[model samples]
Target chain A: MKRVRMRRLKVEKRTNPSAWTVFCISLVSILLAFVVIGFIFLGFGINPLEAYLEIIIETVGNSYGLSQIVWQSIPLLLCGVGLLLAFKTSFWNIGAEGQLLMGATAATWVALFSPLPEPFLIPAAFILGFAGGAVWGLLSTSLRSRFGINEVITTLMMNYIASNIVLYLIHGPWKGETMRGFAYTDQFPESVWLPTIGMSDIHWPTLLLGLFAAVCVFFILNRTRLGYEVKVVGQSPKAARYAGISYFKTIFYVMVISGGLAGLAGAGEVLGVHHMLRHSDQVSLGYGYTAIIVAWLARGNPLIVILTSLLFGAIYVAGDVLQLSFNLPFQIVNVFTGLILFFLISSDTLLKHKLSFRKGE
Target chain B: MKKAVLFALCLVFLLTGAIGLQAQDKLKVGFIYVGPIGDMGWTHAHEVARRIVEDTFPWVETVYQESVPEAKVEGVIDRMVRRERCAVVFTTSFGFWEGTVAAAKKYPDTIFAHCSGFMRAPNLATYMADFYQIYYLNGLMAGALTKSNKVGYVGAFPIPEVKRHINAFTMGVREVNPKAEVHVRWIEAWFDPAKAKEATNSLIDAGCDVFAFTEDSDTVVQVAAENRMPVFGHYSPMYNSAPDYVVSGQLVHWENFYLDFLSKVHAGYYTSKNLENVDYWDLLKEGSVEVGAKFGMPVNPKWKSRLGKTYDLVMERIAQMSDFQMVFDPFTGPIYSRKGAVVVPVGVRANYGHLLSLEYAVKGVVGSWPGEPK
Candidate 1:
């Protein structure tokens, strides 16, 4: 009898993958995710290809859809940029959502309660927004620094606190007088309304600010001494200690910038999107949590986050389109987003490893 | 890859042309819902109404986007108007006020109807199928059957709508048994099962045997029934959830308004420019709401005898409220607040303005009341 010959499979580390290869791999990864999602669409009796085509036409093919997608990205970009920085320092700041809510809260104060004149309202709102977000971020940092509490749990828990805070405000003191028994704050006066691009909801001010943040963070992560320290601390806390890099200061900066940026996103929601402080769910739509996927997909590159955020914006719009056209359930969107995240995460493994086939011994 | 991309583009073009051809001359109507249509309460009723109009009117084409976030309502409206070419849009949710108004201004030629909201534009109108009257009728039954004489009320929010219902229910309870108290608990949400369960359990623990609620789900009814307590269901029918436990509920018939409104739209009566004052604040008289354990079952037969002497009163109240002349209202004159403030003076029927902004607890209510008079 002929001995059964088996072909051996081996896994080896790919030291470095070029940009082109990684791009191709990522593209394939996205397509694979869509292919999987398409099957789910089939389960719902929808033609996957037609649904995909409809989404493309609605979002990129139509001007209004394009603007809405672009508008959706502003919050994600702001939150994602902040998250990538915190992740780089390995601080795992998971409370960008809370920070964003706090920022919106601060913006609401300036817009509604402050005595600031019209000319100063927007600027004052943004400043207070940033400060509000940073303060919320620092609370968790102090706990981690002083008491050695795990930041992941603290950050996640604080998100609930932030949302509840928004809930309490909108339900209580901030409930609009003319809203006639609804749970939301009064609309901001026109003086503080962020200027948009034409008839679209795209607030150029927030979009430009988010881009500027991305660029500045890119530069900081690539060129600065603090960038090097952040990498080392993230890569090895022991090495950071040996090299005399201050973990406290590095984490402090990451938390501040991350939280502050998320706050700015929150303020943008009020100033640019809703023009009022609303329920936290309405204000964010899970942008803070979704931005984690955005940052993760960017693979530590701040500039890459622009594309990732836009991709997420399109995904969200596609979800809306599905609901509009197909009458699918809300969980369909979660499943779609989850499948993409799962596939993208798996693709990250392929970027680091190569598979080989060996002949039988 | 390039060829595949080209093929995809062609498919998109063909699909676009196909959709354009199918659009034809139908009056496209769009609905924006803040919750899923299957929620079995507000949005479900709206969805049912949408289907009715779609089926009944040959010239109407309906589409909807459910679970829309209030912040994203504007975007959904844009897509509805621009992409779907919706001539008439109905946004159902109080939180959608600003978005509906903005969309009304953005699309002047488009007709917009908003539900349960105050702010309206020339192109946007507001409508609501209030059940305070039905709630009062249910309260009458609750007042009669409560063994503990402590009626538990699981309120969704302290908003005026819920407050009005609770007040009306309390009025009915007090009218029947003046010594009985209405214990209230607020869950601070329109629909939250866990919180609803917790609130119901807490109420049960406090020895309130009879129950009524303003939540979007049957959680309160189910919870109360679990403890062998009789309950009045909130929005939608709950006899199926716990048939023996649920006595009666306030049900909304949104299709009455939808059919009337859409027919008017189709007949060119409701144009884009004339909706500013066209509010459809329909109630029992208009048949927009009902008092029942389920549709066509005003009272559970099991509880009919249990109500005994109070069944006649419930029937009478329903008949009076359902009359076009409207002989009686739950919020009649000489009603006093729990703190002795005059809610309604003698012989003064609570008008639309007063009922829409009511924020007081009646004499028999026991709980924290936000926005109550000081």
Candidate 2:
């Protein structure tokens, strides 16, 4: 009893982190990111506390600002949820931007040229948008499945072609007669325009659609048999094949769902936000690309994507706030966002392992 | 759980109270830009004017969001009007036309002015400098200085605004040196330096000794300087960037118009109700559009007299307008399209409607439309 044996401690990896540990790690990572960004604020001759306060006051403090945050989050939510499904299946679909554009183009065509009634036109636009995006998504899936081509290259290249198609249409046949030779199409009729809630920019229908999509995706990935097959194929393709899962069919289905979701985002942007098809930059604003970061930060969780997308949306609103209040350049917002993402990814390693001191063996 | 709920409620109250304290009595003026303010080109020019506005009006507070995409302009406008309480908003991009118009309709109490566009409403007024006047002067210098007789123009887009500039420059080139031809290239972007440099090099390879560009960077001037060729700057002065190659270029002076417009707003002469049908297409006569230099011309020392004479002629013609006689109009008659059809007949000066909607290249231009065969 008097001679107590000395015990040795060891650092070891955890097969899985507890929910409480995951939550604490995320909070700590975000706090550490803010501390680092505070140093940047000081370097810019701005008080860190004041800068953060201004961002909060401008973005989430008022109803108008909150509406803007929600407005910006709609596209991100759709794209992020879509990418969540694609990444879950281990199908690297980098053509969300191209798919988004094709969807907007299709929706715009239906809104402007379709002879359908007001009641039918809106639904038809959504359907056509989904079809357009699905086709674009299938292009890369087919190339990957049929020819074993890397999807990253084909998808990235498709973005340019899709953008050029929009440019050609706006500059040629679809150009508005009264636009004075501008590079934009005519506005959609009021009937096709997504009705907003009260006077705010909150397009409730699209917002509800985004929320519904996240729930549906979560159910598909967690509760459905197809989801079980997808997880198996993603984890171990050889085992999935032994279990009689067709790799081709899984890839096709996942790509279709992913592309369809992105296409719906495009339709929302055109019908709900811009009310017309303009330049690719104006329509998407790199939301499709930004969704990649959103999906990764959410760890492929469709439910988590809602919060992550709103976080990014807050960052965008903060950018405008920084410009308006601090008189800072827009690039400062980029640096801030880049720092947050950097810290979040770096802290990911902490979730898998814990450091402990070891006594002499 | 009760403690957590109480803490959340307290935090919300604190945030709302803190936000309420930020209201001020200052008259906020908001600006929306389509490009970065540090581009040293179009946005920079507007930023410079904004500085003047800030310095001139002590009571007015200025706020701006740069690189606001065209589609998102309406949202920014709404934020400015509703959240920031901005009474007057300036959207400084042609692509923001639709958003500005829609915002004007939505916020009838706020005054909206769109730059480089043609749409106007009761609360929405449009303003633009007569850039073609300066481009024509630059063309005169390019025409007189070039030895290869092949000039190059790197345009940003096929829009009517840019098309008019290209046509005017061609007219100036052919006016002095009839043999000089202006070859055109479209980069399809306004601010891509790499593409601008590539386009400039391609034109240089195509035997263009003198160059003019409508892009939003100094890449063309830098490329021409590297090659020891002559070029003209667009939007801002590029003499410091390329001392040897840049002879003369268009320098947009938005300060005069901005000061004038803001003064009117401050004086209560220009408001939402009176702003309808108000379009400020300021020309060289109004001092809104001028030669590059602050007081006089920024003509290169070598060609000062030759270019100075044309500048004097333009000013003289403006003065002579009070007497109802037009002498040195850039779009004056006998203008021919690239297809050999006379677009502006002899003894007829092109009016604002025709110039604003220019669709075809002039006879001396050596490029076709986007879908046309070269």
Best by lDDT: 1
Q: Write the per-residue lDDT of candidate 1 for residues B1-374, one digit (tens) a residue.
A: 99998997787788788887787689899989888877868888899888988898999999999999987888888888877888989999988877788888889999998998877778888899998998889888888988788999999888889999999999999888888899999998878999999998988888899999988888888788878889987778888999998899988889899899988988889888888889989999999999999999999999899998899998888889889999999889799999999889999999998899888899999988877777
i-RMS, every candidate?
1.4, 2.2
Residues B129-157, candidate 2, lDDT per residue (tens digit)? Answer: 87887788778778887789999999988
Second chain TM-score, each model: 0.97, 0.90
Q: Total clashes, candidate 1?
A: 0
Q: Write the residue-wise lDDT of candidate 2 on A1-361 in tens digits.
A: 4765666666689768877887788878888988998898888899998888777767887787788888889988988898888888788778889888999999999999988878998889989998888899999989988999988898888888999999989888898767777778988888899999888878888889889989998999999987888898888889989999998899899888888888888998899988888888788989889988888888867999999999999888888887766778889778878888888888788888886776653
For model 2, the stretches where C-alpha displacement exceeds 4 angstroms are: A1-10, A357-361, B1-26, B293-295, B304-326, B371-374
Q: Model 1: clashing residue pairs?
A: none
Chain B in candidate 1 has what TM-score? 0.97
Lowest lDDT 10-mer window, candidate 2 chain A? A1-10
